[model samples]
Target: MRNLLMKVSYDGTDYNGFQTQPGGHTIQDYLEEAIRRLSGEQLKITASGRTDAGVHARAQVFNFYTASPIPVERWCMALNTWLPEDIVVSDAMEVPMEFHSRHAAKRKTYRFTINANQYPDLFNRRYQIHHHGKLDIAAMRQGLSHLIGTHDFTTFASRKSTKPSHVRTIFDAWIEKDTSTCRPGTRDQGIIHTFISGNGFLQHMVRIIMGTLIEVGEGKRQPDDMKVILEAQNRAAAGPTAMGKGLMLWEVDYDIASQEKHND
Candidate 1:
């Protein structure tokens, strides 16, 4: 048997999430079904991690094993034929039998978009969280600066999280404006995008961080108080968790040679 790795991207507007559920559509369900149809092999795919409902992914990774001799390039085209419009297989290739997508990942990056404007755009409403109140970017920046480093992010995680450890390293966290107004259909109005890249993330970690920063922007919380919240390690100490729709798993990083060899 040979292992195949696929780089999957999806618009999470309609699906339940990445993981499959009984009587529900999921990214994994479509992927596995497509592979089964093509190779007539029952392949079990393992993803790097799960994204919550309404949270999208630009480059989510998954791997499965198959005995078929289909070429690597054919994987994407064949899968796309069976998959839904919202989900697409961007790249695929055979890998060593031992390479697991979740275990081999080194880092993952997620971005949360905020539509900071007076009115919400109908087209982009499904992808971004709309907030009418003016946000103080300087204050948000200050709060974000405090989040850059290693910390036990228990307070930032959702109370429903089942992860064993809350300690994770955040290499960088920052807010930036959306300068790309060149898109034809997208509303180029007032939009603030928060780009956060970390070594690892707890459940709802980025959303909670965005919420805390939003509070700071509104003057409800001081930027320096972020340290207090992190030290407390209590979920109640953190701000509200942002909505899941605005969150996107942007990228997944791995050892290049390992990834290349896996894609061979």
Candidate 2:
């Protein structure tokens, strides 16, 4: 058997999530079905990680072992032909048999987008959270500053997550204004983008971080409070978890050298 790696992108608005559930209306479900049809063999694919429902991905990586002799370069086209338009395999390549998708990933970068427009944006209702206010970008940056470097992130993770180790290193964190454009008539002045790159993330960690930073931006919490929150080591000490719709699995890196390659 040969190992195959695929770079896939999907509009997660319609599907449940990246992983397959009972109803199978997920990105993975459709992707596996297409591969099954092509190779006539049931394949279990491994993804870099699981994204919550309504969370989109720009460069999600996955891998599977197959005995079929289909050319690696053509797999992207073949998969896209059978998969839904929202879910497409952008590229495919053959890899060493021992390579596993999730374990091999060295870093993950997640982005949380907020639409600070006071007016309702019907066009972007599905993907972005509309927080009506002028957020303090400098305050938010100060709050995020404490999160960089190695530390236990239990305060930012979901209480339901039972991972033994909550210690993770955040290589970088930054905020950008109006980093993306919406459809015509969509408000242009109030877009806030928060990007976080780390070795690994706990469940709901990024969302919780965004929410806390937003509180700092709103003046509800001081930027220095981030240090106390991080030291608390409990979920309740942090701010509320942000909505999943505003979050996206922007990129995954398999090696250290590739982590900052897509900073643009």
Candidate 3:
């Protein structure tokens, strides 16, 4: 058997989540079904991690052991034929037997999008959070600075998380304002995107961070409060968790030496 790694992009608006759950339609279920239909081999696939329901991904990484002799490049085409239109295998390659998707990831970047327009947007509701008020970008930036270094992120993670450790390093964190470019038919004219890159993330970490930033932008919380929140390590001390639809797994990295085409 050979272990294969592949990058996949998916619109998670309809799926339950990335992992397989009873009585739910999930991303893994579809991918495994596609693989089975293509090669007739029952296999278990592993992802970099699970994305919450309604969370989208530009490049989610996954791996599986397969005995099929098909060329790695051809796997994308063959899988796409059986997979739904929302989920597509963008790239594929063979890897050593010791390679594992979740453990091999060196870095990950997640983006949270917010619509700052006052008008109600029915089209972009599934992709971004609609905020009708002006946000203080300066305050948001100030708050982001506190999150740029390595710290215990227990306060930012969901309480339901079973992860053993809350310590994680944040390599980069920033907000981009007034970006007009987006997927066709889903683009809101005015958008603000918060990008966070790190060695790893705990459950709902990005969403919780976004929530705290929003509070700072709204003048409800001071920028300096971020330090206090991180120190408190209490989930209640942090702001409300942001919606999952607004979050996206923007990038994934395995080999830091040679970066992929996607940029943060």
Q: Rank the candidates by lDDT, best first.
A: 3, 2, 1
- C-alpha-based local distance difference test score of model 3: 0.89
Model 1 Cα lDDT, one tens digit per residue, 1-264: 788888999999888889988866888888888888888988679998889888999999999877788888888998889888889999887767788888888888898998876677689888899887777888888888888888899999999889899989888777878745434554344678888888888888998988888899889999899889988999999999898899999999877586666667
Residue-wise lDDT of candidate 3 within 1-264, one digit each (tens)?
888999999999999999999966999999999999999998889999899899999999999999999988899999999999999899998776767889989999999998876665688788899886778879999999998888999999999989899999999988888755433454334688899999999999999999989999999999999999999999999999999999999999887234332321
Candidate 1, position 67, lDDT: 77
Model 1 residue runs over 4 Å out of place are 179-189, 258-264
For model 2, residues 1-264, the per-residue Cα lDDT tens digits are: 888889998889888899989977999999999999999979889999988788888899999999999988889998899998888799887766677889988888998888887664688777778887767889899989999999999999998998899999999999888734544675445678899999889988999998888899899999999999999998999999998889888889876234334332
Clashes of 3: 0
What TM-score do all the candidates reach, one by one?
Answer: 0.92, 0.91, 0.92
Model 1 weakest 10-residue run by lDDT: 180-189
lDDT of every predicted structure (CA atoms): 0.85, 0.87, 0.89
